[model samples]
Target: MSEHRILKLFFFACLGVFVLHFTMTLLHNTPEKYLTPRMESYSHLWCYPTFHQGWALFAPEPQSKHKRMEMRYYGPSGWSEWYRAEHICMDQHIRYRVTHYSKLCHVTQNTVYHLWMAVDHFDQQDRPAEQFYPQNMGYGIAMVLAENYAHHFLPEMEVHTLQIRLILEDPFELQDPEVIHFPTKTLMDGPE
Candidate 1:
């Protein structure tokens, strides 16, 4: 074949591969179960960490609610009083530091929420618990908070364990709304 014809053939082959790869990625990401086990395995092995199963962030009917995280640490003396992780926006007089801390709180909340959604998805799919728990963002946030409390809040004390409680409340409820708590435990000794 002529050199021009050979380059044209190579270009077409590349285009075909790209189209096929895109199609496979779409199929892997879709919620519908259509791919065979072998294809699924291939997709998981190759496309993982890039394409994930679909998940909804919120329901069609959004709830008017507020959420916050409170944490307590086990120190040398005993368990310290619960400290609320206040978002910067919640403060009456917001300084630069307050705004920075508030942004951190927002990021932590978002990460935790995403982790919860992932856990829910895995549970619905009946996947093994070991697949997604240890590396989750919720556990990560707990560890970071424990370390911060030990180093900054009480430098003299060493934090052994942490209890992180996520409180959720619906403001629009007519009756008194009991805050929903998702309590999580974390060992401070774990890898940072």
Candidate 2:
């Protein structure tokens, strides 16, 4: 091959390697894990750290036998930034909570703040099989993280809430503070 052609090929090879490495690193750092009803699905209980954003999350119990999932948060700016997600089971009268939050900021200054997402899911059941206790879905722990954004924004800002949604594969992008909702359900008693 000519000198110019060889140089171009080398450049492309290097670029590909860099991209691969970056992608792998991102997945590794995220620490994704699969969990079932028997085991607690929570990975990192602490604030899910991210750049130019803040987080508060919790892996909660399914309101019913169905709708089991890992709820997560994503966005920029921190405050009473409460965001929630409901994983509606394919076909079952169940609504549960899996609260997961993320945040970012400089480690030096306590310049940002956030709060625990409230009982994001409604407790219409009032009580489940184990009567008495108000069994419902909500933020188990108020996770907080420092969002670093030196590369993007000028003045440091902690994301209070993330514009959450149902994406099979959602990138960690900055979004508005909002909750993602789906049809909720409750089982009914009948003479069957």
Candidate 3:
């Protein structure tokens, strides 16, 4: 192939991948009922690190609420003060050039979003809180991530159980903030 033709072909291929990536990301993030079985089957592609999509820059809908993830740990000394993971990650990101700090900021955002979605699902079904925690994937992931984060940061304290709470406040200051409490997960216990 001629050089010009090769360059043109490469451009189109790059464009194709860009378009496909965003299209798959949109479908993957959409409600499952809206997707056909085949599309739903490919949803896992977006979960890959290379293809991951986030809404911080341009959300489909504007974010109207400020969400914060706060965690507290229970040890022999009793429950510690609620630690704001988001703030810590943001501070680290601001102070250092390390990429892990930025990644943790994104992780905190995803954790809050996942936990909130799980909460909304349970609320709509009128499910009991006891039954919701174990069955929800988001809850399970959040609990484990939160516990690990606590253990990593507060190594001196032995954390038996960690509790996470999502604080949602209106970005415009139009309403009072609401706190969604999650069950305290036992981190020291072995897997069931």
Candidate 4:
């Protein structure tokens, strides 16, 4: 093939890959209910984290409430003072401005968000919120993350158990801040 023809073929190939990738990405980001089974299976296998995309930037229902996470650890000396995860994570981000700092923020925020959603789902189903813990992915991950955060920040203290609290502050609504207290999770066997 001539040099120009080779270059033209390469450009077309690149464009085809780009279009195919994004089309799959778009399909993947869509809700499973809206996608056919074949498409859903294709997207699930192909578009996990590596090719996945988030739609938070174009959020149709923007989050108006500011969520905060706090935790207290129970040890030999009794419960420690409540430590704010947001403050610690934000401080790290402000000082370092690195991916890890931002990820810390995600970990804290995701725990609160997922737990809140889990509780809401249980409520909607007319099930006791307490019952959700056994099968709740959010509860499982939260326990692990909460324990990790406790260890990271309070290395000297032996944390026997910890409880996480989620505070929802809506400045836009001017409503009283709502607080949800999660059950105290034992760290005896480590995270569930």
- Top model by TM-score, which number? 3
| Deviation from native of the Cα of residue 181 in model 4, angstroms | 1.1
lDDT of 1 by residue, 34-146 (tens): 78878876666556434431122444544444556666777556787876655423352255554455665566567557545644565576545455544656656555754
Report the C-alpha lDDT of model 3 over 1-192, residue by residue, as the tens digit.
Answer: 899999999999999989988887788788988999898767654543343223444446666677888988888888889989787778878898666889988988898898888887988887688787778987887887777777676779888888888899975456999998887777675221
Report residue 92 deviation for candidate 3 (angstroms). 2.6
Clashing pairs in 4: none
- Misplaced by over 4 Å in model 3 are 1-60, 189-192
**Cα RMSD, each candidate:** 16.9, 19.5, 14.1, 14.0
Tens-digit lDDT track for model 4 on 61-131?
66666777788888888888888877877887888885588888877888778877766766678656566
- After superposing all C-alphas onto the true structure, candidate 4 shows an RMSD in angstroms of 14.0
| N/CA/C clash count, model 3 | 0
Q: Is candidate 3 or candidate 4 better by TM-score?
A: 3
Clashes of 1: 1
Off by over 4 Å in 1: 1-59, 87-99, 118-132, 153-156, 173-192
Candidate 3 accuracy as lDDT: 0.79
Q: Largest lDDT belongs to which candidate?
A: 3
Comparing candidate 2 with candidate 3, which one achieves the higher lDDT? 3
lDDT score for residue 16 of model 2:
95
Error of 1 at 184 (Å): 5.6
Model 4 TM-score is 0.60
TM per candidate comes to 0.46, 0.19, 0.64, 0.60
Error of 1 at 113 (Å): 2.3
